[model samples]
Target: MKYLLNSNNNILNKLKTKNTLLAFDLDGTLSPLVDDPSNAYIPDTTKCLLAKINKFKKYKVAIITGRSIASTKKILGELPLTIIGNHGLESFYAKIEEKEKWKKRCLILSSNLKDIFDQNEFFIENKKYSVSVHFIKKNRSNSTIKKLANTIKPLLVKNEAIILGKNVVNILPSNKSNKGFALKQIMKKYNLHQALFVGDDNTDESIFEIKKKDIIKIKIGMSRNSSATFYLKNQKEINSLLKLLNDVQTQGINFLCMNMD
Candidate 1:
């Protein structure tokens, strides 16, 4: 993949005239991932850029993430965009549910699996919303997670469930509830000609690979291999890119309106 300078002003110019959408991954692309994922926020530069981008009536911006919707709205606050949460398993327009009652919509992983969370010592550190069974944990065997998966498979066989493996095992809803699916939904809903997706994690690669010929796929963080069309060093670089896009959008709008007069 090429590491393009954040100077995609030409792309923004094209987007100004056509139906376009911007989608972002929350944890690492939009904000640096901290020890606690719920603490992530839109960087100042990103917020400024998004504000500018939102000015275009035809341009739709959305934040797609693996975090729950309530978790996202808490830290992200009210941004001028839509948010696809829990890897697209849950979504909210804005203020649909009070914060306290929002946690009820998470993908209903089998209640039988609740016992697995108790049997493992590492999982004890996990809280209610976030839990991962790390197969590679030291002193623990890899088969532990597999056995757990095997046990849960029967219970979820009738429901929508899938086993996704990364740093650990995740039993997520098997519906079309992924970043890629969410992006497509946004494009169709808005009738966009093209879209841009930026992300920086294993789960994000699911969307990165699905970028159409016209869409731009950007990856953050250092990695030799990725399906991303472009690469940035980290969230700071992503912030810089957002700032540049904001400036371009401001200039593009002024240029467009001036010609209309």
Candidate 2:
């Protein structure tokens, strides 16, 4: 995989129009992963760059994450971008009743799972339409984690979908909603011709599944087997990527203005 900064020029050359969508995952992509999810925040520099990118009318930005919409909004504060939260189950277009139903189901599942797994061993995050089982704080051995996973696998066979991430397992509703579906919905809604997606987790695989020549899929870490077309070394490199994108957009706009003259 090529470095995103090195390939900036080539990527910019391909996406010269305003009809491009810039979508990002929240936790590991925008904000660094932390022990406590609530402590995550977008760096000031990245925030400023995103603001500049949002200023261009030709470009659209979005945040798609496993986080609930309310929590996502609270963390990011006020940003001029679309947000698809709860893994696309709690978006602007989602129905209120549908969300509530999912929430109820997740609650039931969480309660049932709590009986099998000790509450102190793992942290459970109850979102609007899903639940996240975080094991980072547990400090369990790999073999123990595997055993736990095997034990819980059978319990989630009915009406629940599971996604594995870094030290976490997300139990979402067994529905068609996901990050890829959300990306397609956003692209179709805005009539975008291309998109650039950056993420770092198993959940992000859904977005990578989209088979489109115009889409730029970037993974945050160096994973040889990742579905992403490109990979960044770590989360710190995200600032550089954002800066490059801003510079490219500025250059594109200036070039367009020069042509108009």
Candidate 3:
């Protein structure tokens, strides 16, 4: 994988192509990962770049996150961009009353989880289609998450899955509706051929592991384990990417893009 902020490997030129989509994962990509998940927010510098990127006529900007749209909206602050939430489920878009049959099972799981964890210690967020059990590093013992998983595993029925994410445990109604699947759906709807996705954590891996060559995947943190083609050094380095994108649009590609090592 190449270092995104370190070198210009013609990746920006590829992104400038027609029918492109620029997408991000919120928590560790756009916003700093805080001890309390609810307090996470995109910094002013990053948010400003994202807003500018959204206005660019060449690409469609989107935020695909694990947070529910309701929660994402609270932190997103009214950016007129495409937002897909709950890893891929939200808004009850279907017409059939029978379509959301899994909600009842998820609700039961959510309720049962309450008995297993302390509300103060664990942040149990019920996103209707998924349930996330988050524990901060300082509060978590080695066996805490594992024991919790062991207990929850027994309760999982058909169509349910357990995903181990960064400092959190996620129970999804179905693993099929991930960021990669959601990104493809939007691409199909908009007829976008080129795409860029920036994310951190296991949930974002689906997007990184896509088989397409046109899709530029950048994992927030550099890791050989990830299938991403490039990576920004860390979450803080994301500003360099956003800045380059903004400059590419406003300052002309040749003038803004300087020689890189």
- Please, what are the lDDT tens digits per residue for candidate 1 over residues 139-251? 33446656755755665444344434333455453444567887887788778878888888767777778847878888886566578877776677776666545655556
> How high a TM-score does candidate 2 get?
0.89
lDDT of 3 by residue, 1-261 (tens): 888765446577656647689999999999988888889999988888888888888889989988888889999897887888877765333223522765666688788888877887777778866889887454455377677777778878876778667768888877567888888888887889989999987789899999999898999888878889998778887887887887766664554334221
Better of 1 and 2 by lDDT: 2
- Residues 1-261 of candidate 2 have per-residue lDDT tens digits of 766655333665566555789999999888888878878898887788788888877679999999988888887887868999888988876788888888788888788877767778687788858888888474446465556667667876566677777777778876577899999999999999899999998789999878997899999987876788887778878877776667675674222111100
**Each model's TM-score?**
0.72, 0.89, 0.89
Candidate 1: TM-score? 0.72
Q: Which stretches of candidate 3 lie over 4 Å from their true place?
A: 91-99, 138-147, 252-261
Query: Model 2 scores what on Cα lDDT?
Result: 0.79
lDDT of 1: 0.61
